[model samples]
Target: MDKNIKIADSMLDLIGNIPLVRLNRIGKETGAEILVKPEFLNPSGSIKDRIAKMMIEDAEKSGVLKEGITIVEGTTGNTGTALAFVSAVKGYRFVAYTPKMVSNKSRMSIMLAYGAESEAIDIQDYNKKMGLDADDDSSVHGGHVELLPRQICLDLERQHDDIWWARQFSNPWNVGAHHDWTAKEILEQTDGKIDAFVASVGTGGTILGVARALKAHNPDIMIVGIEPAGKAMMGAPDEYPLIPGISDGIIPQIFNSKIVDRVISIHDSDAIDMAHQLTQKEGIFCGISSGANVLASTMIAKELGQGKRIVTVLPDSRDRYLEVEKYTT
Candidate 1:
């Protein structure tokens, strides 16, 4: 046997450990050495793969999921696609739902390619479809974001006994995955030299989990949380953010405001422009959130000065945003 030649038994084996590429062009301009964790290389195409595998395997061990069970969750795109891919490999059915507004057909198509089902429901129709009484007033999880997908998950859980809800937003495994794998990989890849960290917030799993780990390793590692400029999740306005993956209406149960040293909000136009700039300047084909991360990283870098290694995550590829003209065009 060739000792250097090994093989992965399944796609699940390729969840974590992505490349950390230094930003040459952008870093030079900002006078800060920015490095990116290209999470798009994950088998499912985003950092969601890490938590997806962690959540599913943990559920399997705890008997919360089994052969006859159907996995379900509400996701804008990434997490749903991750679950869809994992469920397919584990021989289970998966159903995902997203608010019609945030829904991306490209991501849903990828999920369908993996043998998963998807639904895009109108936010205005949520009250009726979910069978809620006018007297029963229940707000969505994130303040202004669509609540249909979450309601769908709850409804399915109530209607079917053999259903496993991969609640990535509140699941401890979601945080644990990044704490155990993502953060460690970052630390190892950067050789414990990361002076700053930046990432866009969605379910808060990535920032919370990774921040805790990095802080524990070195309390001085500045952890900055990035959000869509208009959409504020922590101590800010709940206006709808233009970006899809971060700064949604509701704050995630897993997200902790205290762990983040500070939060920076980026405007949609600027974020989209920076994302385009990243691809053109650094040859990094990243999504909207990743661009947001770069925008935040550069801001921090300019403040911190040179010789400091600032790290951030490139959440996924540009596949999901190809339809948005301003984001792509």
Candidate 2:
């Protein structure tokens, strides 16, 4: 109530400036110091808030998004929730299409809570409706199980003047947000001494964007990308992720191979195990993709040895996984 007190005009103002915290117990055995950006601290409880705000504001500047238009996007969950959060604040209607029975129900619920429409697209159901066999390869073209939802957004955008698909996978602003804000904050926090940067590849925006900045600051910084076991996100021809955190090997357009030095796959079990370790040992309380990133970071930390510093991101909060029992089980 003090006149001098500072306050945010909107939740949008709290979306960035997420602080980096050092891991004390979990990665101590690795000898190298592991620092994690607690991106879940963002307003919507995930790093996607950064891109959601960026994409919407950029669209406003470019006149693609205007009053009375409904925003549409295909997401696993985080991006949809983030966009819903932003749209609710900015007075736009939001519609998120996610793969049916795949995304965490908690996240979809959060989107709906923000007054957004959350639709689950059942691929096999659509295939059957379209006169294709349930097992047809074309049903999930590009080897991505989530393609059906994206196609729905595309169709809606093409068919309606009031519909604008955010297209986070290919959107330049998705990369721009991290490159301009997330990476800058990391550099400022770490003083540009990062020896390695690691993150789970969802849409591939975070790792690629941060890698660009970290590489420019210090070309020696190793950029490591994490993939769910069997998913070849870094240039391999045919493989897909098992966990919902990683994408379905449909390499996002925002991802660039030039900045990435390595792609490591972590099993779902290993990721879940590490998530528990992060919660119990380090008090991180992150989701499975965060587990994948930290596990891979620990691997790199050991390889880098003592005195090396590695940075990664806890992409979302454990609350999203609470009902799914991904961490509880």
Candidate 3:
């Protein structure tokens, strides 16, 4: 055998260690020290990469997945793209079920680019088929599609076949991954000095994990959850023009409302406008949800008084939402 040793053999090696950048000019405006966890720096340009890797690795360890298996999950954007990236690297075929409102061209391009497959489901169609009222409980209606994948995957498991279903919304592994990695990184980067943590509620994993970690270090720290106003999904009031980076109507089962100190609801137009401002003024090309979170954080900073340290996540990069921006403009 050769004496030479090799290390860091895969792209997965690049999953974490995202950068932490202090927002200088923005902080000056609010008079609160502001830091942004640039999750877009990840290999897949989103925070979901952390959980995507964890979900896949955990499934493999539990023998729920094996070689040549297919992976499936439900996502609107970032999570699906991250899953596709992971599946491509790990030699597993991947598929995603997204809402019909998601742009087909964008989803297909990203999926194909990462060498994965995807299918967009019409939520209205599923609702009608299941005879669910428009305002009926979402959890009950959410399961209609679950059975489709569960039945197939369960049968494969029974036959000792390899198949993985990454139910991100309900997977404890999803929350655990952030608890272990993302939250830890934030604490380390801030040297345990984070006074306030703000994040938009999607799967709730990010906020739950980060909030728990921050509060453990200092109970005085405030944890704020931001959601889109008027049709917000995470137990918040719902509104129209359902924008990206807000709740998707399905509340994540893992989200812990008690841990959140305050919840701010942002308007879709404001989020879009702020996203534009971020690009124009801050030179940070981020998604609309980042804008929503930033808007919420700024408001919180103003409300809480000056000289506070606030950290938030810039969830995904702007490249994914070019279509939305273009269409709106």
Candidate 4:
């Protein structure tokens, strides 16, 4: 964050340099020191803010993005929100394509809140757009939707001449943001005492990027990856991912498997249960993926109990996922 720059100049200025807080309640039983990087404090309310800034600004520097071009991408989650936030403050037009799920409506609302247009691209229709035969099991693969999002970017960019496709999943700037700002902050915040690093694989940008940066500082530092159970990339069954924006059926182009020392799978029940517990005991109201990271951290803490330090990333807060309870008789 550029402190000398006026906040009103651009909210993008307040994107990175978040805080790291010690987990008192969750880590207490495990004995190992557990710390969480509270990325929810970011201006866009998620860690995606870091990548959004870097990607768009990098495009500007490279002359790929201009004043009139529309920034198009596929997401209904934190990445969409961050891009909408950045475009809102930075004088760029943004359009996002998401599956027409009822749950996606809320995320669309958030993008609309920031003046970004949210279009519902029918999943089947987008599959056709990607030249895939929906009926073919080899093509759709019992709902093989891993590439649908990015495919939307590819389609829109080809059709529309003025679209600046922010290919977040494969974008180098995505990794660069975490490597330059996020990893450096962690090193500085922890005074270079980080024993292990843990995070979930979404675009695999965060974990891979931060892992490389941490290892660059100390090769002895342990790197761990958490994925929802059943993600194909991690050699599991292809069940639906409980945490949205965590993973799909395919491995992202930007992810580096070699950067991870350990990869663990978590269940939806365990993640949600831990999320509730975190809210009640630790007072950390984080997103579901954050809970998964916490659950992973707790396991690591238990294994290396006492005297070791473990750090993980809490991707976002709970604001976007909060639901109104249905009243009962």
Candidate 5:
């Protein structure tokens, strides 16, 4: 064997080992020692790359995925981008269903670039009319309608001899991916000195993994789950607009409420304001969910006093949200 020839194959090799940066300005401003795990450096420019890899690989291992089968999922942007990236490399067909409120430019561009098919779902007030019932197979929105797939349909597909859904919310693979990879990296980077972890609960996979690992090492470590004030049902909702936080309405099955010590709800405007501040001060351009996490983390730090170490994950890069004013700033 030639020494120069590498054993591993393809761009998939460049998946993990994202950098952890100390946020000096934000830390000082908040009176806490803050560290941010910059996940945008991953292959697909988001933390979802880890879950995408895990879901695909797990499907393969469990014999659910086969040659030429399509990978399908519902996403906003980041997860779809991640799926497209993985699907392109692995030679699988990728299809995504995203809500219309999501930035169209980003969704279309990412799908086109990665050769994935996309369908935009409309964001009607599903709660008031639909009543949490997934039974309405005939819901229509934006003049572009599609039938809602039943649980049986989903199950059949999973059993389908071939296709995989890569459901990020409930999939054990989602939690496992971060628990094995992200958590390990955090421990190594901090030399096992993490006092608390601050993260937004999107799918809840990131915080669950990080908290599990941190608590295992040091049980006293607190895990604070952050959400938009309008959607923070864990705590009292304080009349904030729903923007860039977990407004998906469906609580992920993988999220363990007991594991999370506290939940903080920040206003969307506050998050947007701080996100701009982050770009101006620390030069770290991140998504609004990250801003929510930072806002909550800073609040926690202020409450606990100084000298405490806290880490938060920046879920995606600001590039995805360029059309929004918060990102432009």
Candidate 6:
């Protein structure tokens, strides 16, 4: 028997250590090697599982999360699904506050399946209620679209003793998870030979965390971040689209610009096209952000040319996108 094949005590125990594989066909013309970490292989079918576990456990250790405490978070889909998965396994109630515009039936169903209660907040409604115009700079700025949902989480935490907000956006644990585990896994898997890293920025935790580790490993390693076109959380104008997993426009507090070398914006059509290619050619069933990440990775690979390696993540599975977008077909 192989010593590495030990059984896990629980699903939570299986969150990380996802394998990194090279893209054989998609980036063939790039010359450089494009490696992908299929984070969808995580227990909850998304990379968010890592931070969900990390934040929850850390809160438990700090005594902020207690018996019967409900875990609440503002998420698009993946984080909520992950928190629900972790909460269900750990015996905690979970609630997800999500943007009404980006809400998808499939994503909500997965969270509901895990016994999580989800509340979709309409940004337009919130803006109207607050007497702010939809086009107002304050309401349309980077990541402002998610502010209402996060505010709801904040209110719940402040009003109820039994409720604890996961705060995945501002939580240091979100960054810590990728830095300590995800990036370490990448470094180990690649034997510290990675020349670049690319990822689609949502809460910005993944890229920020991974950049911190990869840059520390080798400062010259380029770190690139992808955002939906015109919806960049850094400085671009806020825009709406079907790009479900990223660019909801609230520049998360965890986002740090210094470590990131470049920010690339990809259109929804481009992401969908890349997603189709990934599914059809490479057999990697991933979501739109994964498409953006992989697309950005290929661009980086082409720049670096032959012999260099670029690593990126397939952030989530395609199941959440089947009902809403043409991500696969």
The estimated TM-scores of all candidates read: 0.91, 0.92, 0.86, 0.90, 0.86, 0.92
Residue range 1-329, candidate 3, lDDT tens digits? 01132566787888787767777665466678777877887788888899899999998998878888888776557778899998989999987766554433564587779998766656566657678663332322133333334344445446745556787777887888878888888888788887889998877888998888788889999999987675555556766534564565556689878999888888768877777777787888887788887788788777765788888898887787776644248
Which of the two, 1 or 3, has more TM-score? 1
How many clashes would you count in candidate 4?
0
Q: What are the clash counts of all predictions, listed in order? A: 6, 0, 5, 0, 0, 3
Error of 5 at 98 (Å): 2.1
Task: Supply candidate 4's per-residue lDDT for 193.
Answer: 97
For all predictions, the C-alpha RMSD in Å is 3.8, 3.3, 4.6, 3.6, 5.0, 2.9
Better of 3 and 4 by lDDT: 4
Q: Clashing residue pairs, candidate 4?
A: none
Q: Rank the candidates by TM-score, best first.
A: 6, 2, 1, 4, 3, 5
Per-residue CA lDDT of model 6 for 228-314, tens digit only, reads 876556554545444666755666788887888887778778888898899999999998888888888888888899999999999
User: Per-residue alpha-carbon lDDT of model 2 for 27-123, expressed as tens digits?
Assistant: 8988999999989988889999999999999999999899999999987678889999999999999988877646667888899999998787776
Candidate 2 at residue 319, lDDT? 90
Positional deviation of residue 51's Cα in model 5 after best superposition, in angstroms = 0.5
Candidate 6 structure lDDT: 0.83
**Which of the two, 5 or 6, has more lDDT?**
6
Of 4 and 6, the candidate ahead on lDDT is 6
TM-score comparison, 1 vs 5, better candidate: 1
- Residue 293, candidate 1: C-alpha displacement in angstroms: 0.3
- Give the CA lDDT, 0 to 100, for residue 294 in model 3: 78
lDDT of 1 by residue, 205-290 (tens): 89999999999999999999977655467655544466767745577788889999978888768878888999999998888888
The lDDT of each candidate is: 0.82, 0.83, 0.74, 0.80, 0.73, 0.83
Candidate 3: which stretches are off by over 4 Å? 1-7, 101-104, 122-124, 132-160, 232-238, 325-328
The candidate, 4 or 5, that scores higher on lDDT is 4
